[model samples]
Target: MPASTSKSPRVAVLADSDTRWKWGALTAHRLVPGGRLDGHLLRGRATPTPRQLGEVDEAGVRPDSVTEVTAAEFLATMARERYDVVVLALVGGGVQAMLHGLTHAWRGRERRPVVVTGYVGVVYEKVTDGLLLRHGADLVLANSRRDAERFRAVYEGVGVDASAVVEVALPFLGGAPYRPADPYTVVFAAQPSVPAGRADRAYLLERLVRHARRHPDREVLLKLRSRPGEHTTHVEELPYQKLVRGLRPPANFRLVYGHMGEVLDRADLLVTVSSTAALEALHRGVPTAVLTDLGVREALGNHHFVGSGCLVSWDQIDAGRVPVADPRWTQRNGVAPGDAYGTAFDAARGRIAALLGGAGPGVIAPYYDARTAPGYVPGLLARYHLGVDGVPLAGAPRADRPSGPVRQVVRRAARGAYRHGVQRVAPVVRRLGEL
Candidate 1:
């Protein structure tokens, strides 16, 4: 990689889902002000659809180009592109697999691009395992002061280098400060799988409808991430849309979908189970709540908001109680009231700049190698259609495809079928097995 291109630095982001793509694309623009940014979306079960991309691209991060690639195909494209920076906005396993695969593919290269990886939102589970899985990159972005501290502890505790951890805030956290729209709006940022059961999801919807009835003067909006046939970052077994079918609500209550920030424009209160939208709402100074009615459990992720003072029950919310976030908690978690968020990415930008201007960073050395992760590594890479040798499997797609309309349609149909199986067929089959 002795600088194949002579102009501005090249940045390529490899993303898996819509949320990661939004974070990665926005991060690229933040890291390199004018650098050419291209995107690679891994072909998978959760690959962002055209509609989903359009939803998040409102941040003005529509990439110069977006291509679909498998793990081996991405590596092959990396060999030819000679990018200045590569961002891995993927799940933990995907990041680890790509790190090892890239290490092998770029062996003995004259120079290598700086690699980056990080989480999309609050890290509420599998702290050690997830951090170590994303261990090997030039920089592993920590989205808050607390996250940075935890990340450092995990790396040092395991005898790994902790210098790569850099503090940064969520990239998509900018919008007009809350001005309080007329009629006083309430928006519930729905989660796909936080509750992960039809009973819980339906109960929540019933509560929302009841709330609308309780306060007819105030407008209530259910902000959904995707429709019935679509997939998002998480597997939505029971969409709120499906649950709302059996309930009749007042005209004042409605379901809406678009950019989260746009909906925040009219919101006087933001409520969620544990979606990242709560942080976004806090960034824009909207009154926010993390529901505790389901119990403050790690499984629901509401426990992460315990000290934030945003936790409240729907019973409390309906009783005219407004939740206020703790300032110390907000600052610690990177919500940083006022001008602090404007500088959240300053450190990240400077770090990337130094790496680009100075000597190249060393090779990508993931924590899990064949010897270290003998029981797990092979299967993980195999799912991406990569062999134990880190080469493309015989039947795997080996090149990045700017897919045509027909291919796109077929891909959509295949994904719809997979989601249907997860949501419908599997549960019945399991029940039958039990009987």
Candidate 2:
């Protein structure tokens, strides 16, 4: 690859959802003025559905410009084109796929794009050794100092050099100023399929309804991550609307969706069970309540909010209590919204520029090996062959072609089975259980 004649660096953001696209967009928007930024909607390993693409478009990302790429295509594109930097804005197995493909493409090559990896949310626990080992990134951007430290510790524990990890402030926090809504509104942000296995969806909604009934004048909004019938990265654990249909919700109760900034702006209070939105709400000075009725610590991961003074239980919400946020906690979390675009942002920009300017460090050897490790092969196949909807890389075996159609068929069959169980089998099962 030859050096670019243009003054600005060329960047490609590989994203699979609206959340990731937002993160990538922020990275692109903050680049030193005239850098070329292109956003791609990844298909395999963690591709976005059409509905997700629509939502991303609605959020102001140019849909026409956002190309859809599979793992093979991504690798092929990276190999064929010369990009100054390539940012990975994927989550879960998608990250593994991208890392594997990129590493495979750049193996034995002299020139390669600076691979950047980061999280779209706050890091609560130890950075997974598996993720770092498989990352294959030239740099890893941490959302906060705490996360950066965690990354360093994890890297060191895994015997990998941790110097590439850099701390950066949350970009989503730099949005519009907070404006409190009238009528004392409360928004219950719901997360149905958290990794910790907290299955209190019904209980949470019931609690919210009870809260709304107790105070008829105050508006209560059920802010869902994804509405019913909408495709999201997470599995549809519970259809919340169905649970509340028989509860006779108050006139003030409503389901809402929009930008987090807009939702929080209209919210006087936010209640949830371990959601990143809680951090966003706190950053805006909106009172928040972290529910603990189910008493599952690991599942909810709300323990991070303990010292924040925002922890509460259903008992407290029923008692009409709103938890106050601890200022020290906000500062410690690096989510202090009052920073006014501090030095962290500038530092991140400078780091990216330096990498583009050829001052960046070399790719760690462990990540290079991790891509081809036996444990990573399944994930690579899932993402590149079975998950994506694009052409396979040239010279790749026929067996490497994606089985997207088969996966879709299986998903549809599962959904159909679920509907049948609820409509036809549940009644009989309940009757037999009563006997």
Candidate number with greatest lDDT:
1
Clashing pairs in 1: none
lDDT of 1 by residue, 122-148 (tens): 899988988888998888999899999
How well does candidate 2 score on lDDT at residue 94? Answer: 61
Residues 1-435 of candidate 2 have per-residue lDDT tens digits of 123535567778888766677777666555433567777866532244555455444445442256766556667777677777787887745665676566566666665777777877766544584456435576677777677777788777767678778777666664455566679899988764653222367677888888888889899999876655443444543567667778888899998865666688788888888878887787777888887787647655776677888888878877878788877777767675676445666766677667666644464344434244556555454545532212344454343355587866865566556645653476468769979
Runs with alpha carbons beyond 4 Å of true place in candidate 1: 1-6, 400-409, 430-435
TM-score attained by model 1: 0.95
Each candidate's clash count: 0, 3
* Whole-model alpha-carbon lDDT for candidate 1: 0.86
RMSD of each: 2.0, 5.1
Residue pairs clashing in model 2 are: 44-388, 45-383, 385-402
